[model samples]
Target: MLNSVYNKKQKPSTAGETTQSNKSWWKEGILYQIYLQSFKDTDGDGFGDLNGVVEKLDYLKSIGITMVWITPFLESPMVDNGYDVSDYKAIHPRYGTMEDFDRMIYGLHEREIKFVLDMVVNHSSDQHKWFKGASSSRDNEYYDYYHWWPAEKGEPPYRHSLFDPEGGWDYVEAVDAYYLHTFTGNQPDLNWENPKVRQEVYDIMKFWAEKGVDGFRMDAFQFVSKDTTWPEFPEGHEKDYVKWYGLRPELHGYLNEMYNKIIGKYNVFAVAEGTGSTFEDAHNLVDSDRNELQMAYHFDAVNLSQTPKGYSLLDFKGVFSKWDNAFSEKGWLAIYLSNHDNARLVSRFGNDSDDFRTVSTQLLNTFLMSMRGTPYLYYGDEIGMTNIDMPNIEEYTDIEAQGKYQSALKAGADMEEFINTLNYNSRENGRTPMQWDASENAGFTTGDPWRRVNPNYTEINVAKQKTDPNSVLSHFKRMTEVRKKNPVLVYGDYTLLLPEHEQVYAFARELDEDKILVLLNFSESESEIELVELQGLTSEKVVIDNYEGTAVEGTCITLRPYQAILFSLG
Candidate 1:
């Protein structure tokens, strides 16, 4: 049985009671992401449900995670997974009923784990009652519930914009109007400009909160409002079309109003998925004064690359510097190496070899968890899960990958090149079923999983890692313990040490009288550092190491391939 580290009403510091304070809970708390579809299947339905999550509360609490962020389980058409909601008030039948949702919420609360649900308000499935009524006729009271435009002279509105990836926009012949869809044609963008729509959304949010959800992770939040004029961008900047809809000057007013009406009254935690936002955008949304959200997940750090493909090659120094500057000047940042939408960190940053992957994973955890921000851990990240190698487009479930593959082919790219890119960068790599054991389907299900399990489950399963003291899972637990034991890591000032080191990352976190230094060797070879070089911090004791084990010395220290060390100094 999983160990119980938390209990109802136990003090936050004691591991039993959930903390109610807004001051530092976010700063010190650890958030775990649960992709419900692949977590655990109950009743052998070949899909994970709310009941499955309820049964795993003890497993989460045992790992020292304080917050649980589950992706959308609301009623949806599943056009883009659950992102296209048909009814915000109802639960998806495939996942479970509303009663099941309540049970999961109360169970999490009983275990002192705050449950966060995905709030997809940016758009709704075309089948949503609101969209349905609006599309039936322009004279309907719900006509203004979504964005709609009419073509001139029997021609459609400027086809210059690629709103729907499938080529054409949906039109209601009876109403003689076309609706705007930023993603799939089946998902229509909500008209936030309408007061009725805004009020309705607020009421829906309150309804869920009253049901016992502790918080929400807003999806595509920045795109809620758009320029109603639908002005066409200059043809010169066709490549930058995606940016035309984000962070309008009027966005803050809409967000502030929504927060005041729905989020403010409940005093719940909220984190927006500000996909195309800068640090300034984050500050405007989640400053300390709590004007908007409590925090936001920014994609700046994750966008770094090894090729000039998406954003330029990953610049370590530039990325760290930007983060340091942003957090110091604005609000706290949410640090993560991988999520449900990105490739695994181990595969992206370290040698594919198990030993090196283990070390690099630990190093990443230490660096991110020790920083002055909330840390989020993806499901399999704690045990060093690698990216799944998808053999063909048919094996992928993510719509973005499929669209990109077809687009690449249309753009004259060879099939082999497209496949290679998809294998390395597609989001499906992160969505494979969790590796729980070496048993069939990685022990994630009694039957076949919705998605294929990683073939490496035999070596990377959680069952084996939990029993091994030095496994990546154990290292993650140790890292969490260290964060809890040392207040410096929880509420400390972060200062990057030796920023000039090309292959080494070093930093110091200090709080009051306590100080800790984190050193990471980012390469597959040994690196040495003089004790005096660590900004007057003498290597008093090696608290943890990703190498063989922690070793203490007087003058200098050596780190093995992809190793990391945490030292406590007086």
Candidate 2:
């Protein structure tokens, strides 16, 4: 019915009659996200560098990745691990020199692997030249580059800071004014309302486009546009923050200008870090006719399992299904489970215990690759990396975790409970060094690593899984190959099955004469999934399965614990 709901809307041409050709490279290719600092380290200075990524091109190709999204390697204060950019056009010495960056870029292009740079324009590190000038005097040329309110205004209306407990406004004695920072105090929010500031951001994007970068992942862009009047937000408004701060009507205007000035000219696509608060808001940002962005990367699913109680299977299914149905007609979506800002996929959404880690990781990957949108797979997920077991706040290196810890301490919250939740939900859990082998520092670095490697690396490293036929890495390779070979999986009509099933998530993707049914068991108990809606159709072949063999009689099949199976239907 959700698919039919979109039938009345204008429809675009499908992928193909038998194989895909109509879709652009971005829509057809698989995207792999590499958190630059955690990926690999060629230099022994404890930081991962550009040459480290250059060395892994062949490995990325082996996993069937066609596109790579690298987090900020641009010059930064590293206050937020490269998100607090001080210089957008220059490479950070911690990452490597400009020459090394060019080599990395050339290596990717030579392998036909598209590169997507992380664009963090919402804010700039206070150490930036523009911020320095802006804080110098009221008459400074760059004073308009950032948001500032004179201290004489009594107290500016309240705004929440994600990192600062004091609030979003920080008093700068140099100019006797307060500047806005939506994140850490060291990172000041840019004034997009100013023409000069907007031009600066556009120039930054163009600089990358000139470097042959294929695309950009705009970080925290949903909150870029502000009301500027700095009206008082009602108490408790921070609970539903995006509704108040995101998708201002003026944002579309800026996006339209950016597309005409840079994105369209460079033939590059842009995906926002998040959509606005509603389905309508999401559509307005990314619909093709809107000419703003190419895809919406929403957070509804990623935020679901952030609590100690975990998430329900039905709620998990609903979030994804709702997103898919919302984008069925016009706009597009970026599908993912885990990323640099969240805990590992297996730890958050699947069973991470040794008994089921491999199967559960494979099952989750099957869901991601089988979905309708372009899937974005995080690095280290291929080998089933789980969360780090950190008991004390001192073990954490992420600013987010440290901020939360201090906030809880100041609020008189229970430290033990907070630490327990932090262990399960901290973003640092996902930022640990990649487990390349069982060697010292997991083969990520020979010298001291910036962060401690996960202790289980000896058992779950890539070298251990690389040669195993049934390893998580192998299943990932097979699933990607299957998706690459089947157009139906990429651009198909998704129809949910077993909508009320507690443990089994089932769906069918059909394009023309080709139809594939996917079944995933989300629990440790065996699940009997009877495809009642698909009674008349029979499976022509077992397309892929996590388990060695799949047993199906008619339209019913028994799914083993954490099993994933795909069947080509006749």
Candidate 3:
């Protein structure tokens, strides 16, 4: 079994019996994701580089982070923020040289932090040599490297382009054909059906693995294998497009091939961007005997709320509970609230308003840490960063936002309403410069930042929170500590308590003789929760609490606004 590597020794339970631990470092270790451009800047360039990341290795270790996933800094035109790979073997000059990358990896390893490279193989930049050759002439050796439809074919089947509202096919005059780009025109989707393309991708992985990259987060990989026949779908199929275009049966063969050729050879953790269209699809990709990926990273919970109306607590609970139940026995899961592709965690999930921000942020962190999977904490989230206000469309920097705005204009959508909603959902809201201190540009850079820093950085920053023991930063560090000490938190069974509770989310984790109860109040009002499941178990000492204190009596607890508490049960 793939998880056999996880078999180890666990902490002794209260019954004084030592149990075998199913703790995989990838499963037990907390992952910190660094949005490269905003993390820290060296050489006064206003852009973060590999050296800047090396300088902060100690800080990442301070927060109890055992693994770090840095976003793409590979050679690119920066068209889709390094997702469009121009050269797989070279480092972009803007970020730094190959030597810097080697040094950065060494630094992370020195701190015992595993490195996870963001592998974007779904597409390549049009400027890439292979793409350039493929586009130049149909007779070229790289002509079949990408998907193309002949101009004489009278337009390819309807395909959805996430970034380009216009369409997924772009006509290239040189080859008299249209190329497919699920994202933007500059990013042409690679033809995974081709054996050569698969080998090319495997070779790239081998190169990185040789460089000591501990793992690979396959970006947009669910969409990598497509139906080359380009079958047409009924109208509005785009709404549930993942079912239509993602996770084709053939993708499994390619994944198995890659696993045998690269992943298994390296013995590294591999997680895909999306968990196909259903639970069965997710399991097929990640089940231990499947010999494919190791972890399932789904967007069900994050996609639940994208508007100001907020999401239903019932829906939130259902989504998480259903996923946990699906993967409880066999496959593994990745737990996270927000990442580079979404808005700030606190702003979208927790209360980002002044009075509730701090406590609410801490509450969300508690939920993440106590969950049944590896928690991926985004950079700047430890300091409780809020979404920056971008009232105007002109202020947005993400290609997804800009391209979608153009599409809305062409569709005659309400421009004012669009910008307002985009402000709440634009990924750029989460990509702002990291708030390091109260200094200019929040001390992320000595030079003017590439993007505007959030004005709230004056009050919300690592420097300020580092001193306050009750601050969100400290709370995050403590949660990591608690999780590290409790092996049950990583491999224990999760049972959702008070599943229909309006303002409070409660759950319990248990492994053999050790049991833990976690309660979280998601709203800004004082809430009380009485867990029927807690009646038999005697509540022991508080393991960790977001607020200064927790009020517990019998089977009930009065939770203050955004209060979160975890208690051991005897």
Q: What would the TM-scores of all predictions be?
A: 0.91, 0.95, 0.95
RMSD values for the candidates in order, in angstroms, are 4.3, 5.6, 4.7
Tens digits of lDDT, candidate 2, 357-451: 99999999999999998899999999999999999778887888888888899999999999999999888888999999999999999889999
Query: Clashes in candidate 2: how many?
Result: 0
For candidate 1, give the lDDT. 0.74
Task: Name every residue pair that clashes in candidate 2.
Answer: none
Against the hidden true structure, what lDDT does model 2 obtain? 0.87
Q: What is the C-alpha lDDT of each candidate?
A: 0.74, 0.87, 0.87
- Per-residue lDDT for 395-457 in model 3, tens only? 777899999899899989998888888999889988999999999999999998899999999
